[model samples]
Target: MLITLGRRYLRPYAPAIGVLLVLQLLQTLASLYLPSLNADIIDDGVVVGDIGFIWRTGGWMLAVSLGQVACAIGAVVLGARAATSFGRDLRHDLFDAVQTFSAREVGQFGAPSLITRTTNDVQQIQMVLLMGFTIMVMAPIMAVGGVIMALRQDVELSALLLVVVPVLAVVMGLLLWRMLPYFRAMQGRIDAINGVLREQITGLRVVRAFVREQREIERFGEANTALFETSLGAGKLMALAFPAVMLVMNASSVAVLWFGAQQIDRGAMQVGSLTAFLSYLMQILMAVMMSTMMVMMVPRAAVAANRVVAVLDTQSSVVEPTTPVPLASVNDGDGPRGVLRFDDVEFRYPGADEPVLAGVAFEAVPGTVTAVIGSTGAGKTTLLGLVPRLFDATGGTVSVDGVDVRSFAQADLASLMGLVPQKAFLFSGTIASNLRYGRPDATDDELWAALEIAQARDFVEELADGLEAPVTQGGTTFSGGQRQRLAIARAVVRRPRIYLFDDSFSALDYATDARLRAALAPRTADATVLVVAQRVATIRDADQILVLEHGRIVGRGTHAELLASNATYQEIVTSQMSLEEAA
Candidate 1:
């Protein structure tokens, strides 16, 4: 999974990667060459007391030293550029893949997991790239070159490398083996911590309302502690691996010097040769240490890569048509206006035992208002969601103007319908910016016109900055009703063919709700209006009312007609409205 994901996104940067590798190879060769030159400076120049030889050797050494510095700096710059570009491209692809997913796929991978995959997982792979570019490419080159250089200094001492390198590899390999499972476990812990944090933050208001702050805090602590324990275990293995490599390296250096001294005493080797051999041995061991560090990182990066791949591999339940149904021309046959229909639709959430909405049917003609009213959990919001295809119905079809919604491309469907969700959301921006979301090209006059119809203009005008007044994230600056009004105005600016309000007026007072509805009536007369209201009075005068229970429509009539025969409707009216209002 790691290799596959890397190849796909890293394909574009092949030239940059090549440059990084070339720089690392040059740097490694220059580094290895300098140690041998130092040995020559000592043996033939100083030992023979020849000033001319010293000057000549010193000059060559200075040139090699400069080349090494240049190569190191060049490799670092190129590696950083390649690694950063790879991370950026991977992040872009992950975000795009997520955007294409339907609500069902999103539910399958919870928001916390998705967040982890995009951010934490991508970071893991990016760190690996940084190490791979800087160290991995150089380690092998240094190790092999160091071996040959050490042999040239003296072959007898070169035997120490065989024993030292293998022992270090075994110790580091064992540590890496033990860490793989724990790294996988650590990622799961991160997901748990992220999930708890996200839930607590998003529901802070509810937690305070219910007075569960202490309980939530305890829950977060448990998650945090579990993560700490797993991390400590991984850390212990890493701690052991590095020191073990150093021990073997130190032992090998001691062994080489101990044996090399005997040869020097017997007049079989030069002092310069013994010193150069030790330098080559140190280089070889340092290369092993560098490779070992990358080995430890591999397990963690592998786990994160698998998680990212899972998100990319899973297909969204809702997909676009290869050849979409053509959109209606500007002139509506239903007369150039937005007309919506739901024809015998049935929908069930994924993995659910039964359907949430069963065999429902409705139509809202252009210039008419169709109100859907029911008690809580009667599929009111579910029905509204189908029109916009937020979730496709399991059976039957939802359409606009004689064509199935699935037939139209997502953008075309969005252009024709404006929806104000049950829980209103506003971005962190000025009032004008939020309004522009509905119609990016809308002029200032059009924005004010929508605000007027949505009953939001008065409060907006009273603010010192008016349209420029800043709205905090999620409109935390405004009261519930104020946020709802802004959300409605955002929809109104679109001037779409269809308008869906899924209990959008519940936050407003009776008088305000009444006035807002009255104000909206004229502006939406040319567009289809669908309102899901909890209050009977809110939809009393609609062209049609559909009362639902248990995902089925139990009553369908005008207020007076239902008052005569629908017992359920009569009971709901009696509970919420006065006898006089009910009559």
Candidate 2:
């Protein structure tokens, strides 16, 4: 998985990586040449007391040193660019893939995990590339060159490398292997912490109202502690790894010097040769250390890569049409553009015991309001979701204008409807910016008109910035009623063929709800309107009303007809109002 992701995302940066490798090669070669020059300067120039030879040799050494530094700097710069570009492309692809996901897929991984995979996981991969660029490419070159140079000085001294290199590799491999599980655990813990924190922050109001701050705090602490434990476990292994490498490195250096002294004493090697051999040995060990540092990051990065690849690979359950029916010219199919129908529509979440919706059937046509009223968990939201293909019907077809929704391109299907979700959301922006989301090219006058119909213009007009007011993320600055109205205004601005309100008016007071509905009546007169509501009064005057129980339509009639005949309708109505009010 790791190699696959690296290959795929790094494809575009091949040229940059090639240049970086060249730089590292030049730098390592220059670094390897320096010790040989020093040995020559010592053995021939100093031993024979030749100042000119030393000067020329020293000048060459200085030039080589400068070239090495320049190459290293260039290599690091190129590597950074390639790694960051890889991250940018990967993140963009992940976001686009996620955007195509239906609600079912989003729920499958959960939002917190997806967020971590995109940000933290991608960062891990980037870090590995950064370190590998600086170290991994050069390490092998330096180590091999050092061995060859050391053997030129004395083959006997180079023998220490056989023992040292293998030892460091084994120690680092074991330590990293043991630490892999902890890194994996740490990522899971991070997701848990993120989930808990998000839940607490989003539901802070509910938590405080129920006086569960302490309990929430304890929950967060538990998640935090779990993360700490995993991080510490990985940290301990990392801590052990370095000292173990240093031990092998120090032992090898001691063994080289002790053995090289015997060679010098026996007249088999000069002092300059011993000095150069020692330099080469350190270079070889240091190369091993550098490679070890890069390897330390690999296991974590590999795990992260797996997670990211999984997201990219899993296709969305609501697949797009292979040959999409173009909605633009196909709007005249069998009925008016806004007509919607459900035929034995059913939805069951993966692994659930029973379906959320079963054998549900209904139709809404242009120029009329169709209201769905039901108890909590009666699949009101799920039923509305089917029209938008938020979740495709597991058992039947949902059609718009007599064409199956799956047959049309997702974007084309979405263009025919304006959906105001149960939980109204607004991006952080001005009133004008939020309203323009419905139709980006809408005129200011069109925006104000939509706001007026949605009963949101008065409050917006009173604000100091009016249409340019600074809205926070999720429209958190506004009251619930204000947010709902803004969301409705956004939908109104679209003037789409169908308007879907999934209990969007639940936040408004009776007067505001009534006024908003009244104003919207004419504007949406030629469009199909679907309202899913909990309050009995909210849908009482609908042209047609359906009362749902356990995903089935228990009653279908006008308010008076359902009130007089449907037992479930009567129970719901009398629960919310007096018998006289119910009339």
Off by over 4 Å in 2: 332-335
Best by lDDT: 2
Candidate 2 TM-score, true structure as reference: 0.97
Which portions of model 1 miss their true places by more than 4 Å? 328-336, 578-580
Candidate 2 lDDT, 160-196, residue by residue in tens? 8888889888888898789878987877898999999
Model 1, 406-516: lDDT tens digits are 988988888888899999999999999999997889999999999998889999999999999998999988989999999999999998889999999999998999999
Task: Pull out the clashing pairs in model 2.
Answer: none
- Candidate 2 all-Cα RMSD: 1.6
Task: List all candidate RMSDs to the true structure.
Answer: 1.8, 1.6
lDDT of 1 at 450: 90
